[model samples]
Target: MNRRNLLLCATALAGSFAAAPLALAQDAPIRLVVPYAPGGPIDATARALAERVRESLGVVVIDNKPGAGGNIGADVVAKAAPDGLTIGISATATHAVNPWLYSRMPYDAAKDFVGITQMVRVPNVVVVNAARAEQLNIHSLADLIAYAKANPAKLNYGSGGNGSAGHLAGEMFKQRAGIYALHIPYRGASPAQLALLAGEVDFNIDNLAAAAPNIRAGKLKALAVTSLEPSPMLPGVPALSSLYKGFSVDTWWGLVAPHGTPKAVVAKLNKAFTDALKTPETKTRFAALLAEPVPTTPEQFDAFMASERAKYQQVVRASGAKVD
Candidate 1:
């Protein structure tokens, strides 16, 4: 062969060799880690995306790592090999609030992971026990505030955990409304909701999904949702922002991979998941959970995380919330 032809042949062969491994890698099953127990909003949303991702990516598995207020599961993804095969579902609590809520966090939210995309933003609802509401004559946000001012520490509020989004939302409500209520933290939303239902706690700011059935069944009384607008599921309920101007607190879920994951892989994951959000079935599911589907590019997700981190830092300082 001529010298020029020889050079071209060699270049083609090297390119083929380099491309072979990547082709194989693309076919591997991607692992998506959910940093909470099954049945929670994060897990449900992750599984929904995973199903669609499997159709787009060929194979995907959802792995639930539920402990340490979601930090344990998040750390596993943070430390995993950044080969693009391992990804995680993280919420505002894990990425934005935990750093400020805990004196020491296991991983740096910004540095330890590269954001893929935000999947959904779920609003929380302020729910009171029907019995408690009737007994205390707490019929609305104004009534609740009046009761709190009158009762002082007599009224208590429950949350999912010390550093969870619900806890922060409750604290924000306390600070914004200038009310005094005892804060009770539980392992997760189930126990906290149970406490409110059983009258162990007077009220709680809880995920709308967990509180929906109770509210519909008349077991729990929903006064106002924590979002800027009223939730479609509970249209009769008012928004907290209506009571306290500019008041809004929401729990959101996003996808992330360990830092240094291949750019192509991250792009692929983002495309697959974002596309999944556009599907009619996915939209309906999100609506049922009172979670709005929020699909964003990686850059947008990163910017969102930064803003959330700053916002939560201010909230933590203002509320004086900390994890021991």
Candidate 2:
């Protein structure tokens, strides 16, 4: 675990901060570790929920730790003492996909962390730089396929990192389209979006929330949403399944404490977060980000995780993605 773990003094936190008034920020704040860079979908969600959770839980802080496809930060939480003070805001990539993709994982996704509650689910969109899309005359998924088929390796895509949901989606796209494209992996989703903005890659399948501002600003053109149905956030963007049947890939964010965290503590944390999600301000903010709040109980979240992990296990195996 990182030396920063010692700074939180997590075990002593309840005694020091729990009794403090909620209005007055506590001396020892709960650290909400985010395994991705700032400005991405997960970061935005974490910061938003952190404010609301603080009101009920005393004080909460967001800690960004991006690397190894989110395992670095997740491992930090996994290894931390099972105090409620240390928890991580994780995504599908971190909790479900990484376990199957990496040969030697830093932590066990299912066993190392106790599920608190899922915060929200954000659909992903296939997008290209507006200028490039215009130049290439790619107006939709069909156009993208035609272009890629005509130009083989000329087409390229960017992803958050190897074994990330974005990476798997890109591979699925190529496999279904019968086209070849080079893969460019970045440290985080926001960095991948930056590369797309600079035209570093031809396209990217990015979370709609992270790409919404740019797409609305015309910096990027959303061609298709990676869901069974079209995204309500981007109603005009067609669903990828329209082009290739049964296509789906949506990313989500949620909270989890280290394994052995008391069930009572987990329930308390879940209540705080779910209460935050029900707030009007938080709801409006999450809508603006194009994420739907989905607060779930620990048992429900555990089952959801199992189903998602099983679904992505097949995806990773079929994609032949290896993070050895």
Candidate 3:
């Protein structure tokens, strides 16, 4: 055979060998653990990602084991075999906020897992029931603050249980705005959103992906997003940072494997999901949730996780959010 032909065959073989693990991942079915219950944003993202990632990762299976505000499911992934098969979909709640909010954590956020790739970032937004907004004349963050200050304890904000991002954002808003409002915690975002729709609560700071439908349907009115900059999904909506300089809060989700997983496996998994994130289909599906696909390298994701935990530690401490 010609030298060129020989080299071509060798190159093809090497490429196939490199992709062997991806094929193995499919055959073995990578256990994609969503630390929260099914039907939530994280779970939905996992399911969507699984369909596309399967083209690379093989048949991915979502396993939901929600408890202790994501700690229970996270711990399960942390202790799983370091074989890269048991990867978890972690969020700000599991990796960043829980360490500071919960009195006793089931697993160490930074130490127990290896960062894979950040999947998506869901902007948190402050929404008031449309009727309540008109009744209180709260059209903007500033207006809400003024009304809240004027009527302390009369207005209430709901959250997806204590220590959730919604709760922390509310507390941070209170601290930054220097306003007082009662906090009512619910079992989950659905209930909190329902409470707002039912007029049980005046407002809520919730994930835009979850609240965007309601806002578009006119069931709720979005005042601002809890991000440093504006979100395209919520056009014309002011960023909370615009109102409270330096104020920013966004809930992000990522993939993580049990620590000690082979670096090659980590690299394969990262490529699979990051590649999935680039697809137009995934982008369209994620848009439905009002989430933006954010793909990052393992090292970058690790650094990002550190910054998130550090930022939320103070918020949780200041809010005095306890999940004991």
Model 3 lDDT, full chain set: 0.89
Predicted structure 2: lDDT: 0.85
- Model 2: runs farther than 4 Å from truth? 1-29, 37-40, 150-154, 186-191, 194-200
Residue-level lDDT tens digits of model 3 in 194-308 = 9999999988999988898889999899999999999998889999999789898998989999998768889888898999998999999988888899999998999999999
In model 2, what is the error at residue 253, expressed in angstroms? 1.2
**What is candidate 1's local distance difference test score?**
0.86
Candidate 1 stretches with Cα past 4 Å from truth are 1-25
For model 2, residues 46-67, the per-residue Cα lDDT tens digits are 9988888775777788899998
Q: State how far residue 104 of model 3 sits from its true place (Å).
A: 1.8
Per-model TM-score versus the true fold: 0.90, 0.81, 0.89
Candidate ranking under lDDT, highest first, comes to 3, 1, 2
- Tell me how far the alpha carbon of residue 77 in candidate 3 is from the true structure, in angstroms, after superposition: 1.0
Q: Per-residue lDDT tens digits of candidate 1, residues 1-324?
A: 999999999999998765543454378888889988898667888888888777677677889898776799999999998877888987888898888988888999989999889999878899999988998888998999998998788888998777677778888998888888888999878999998989999999988878989988999999999888887778789999998888888888899999987677688778888999989999998887778899999999999898899989998887787777
Model 1 reaches what TM-score against the true structure?
A: 0.90
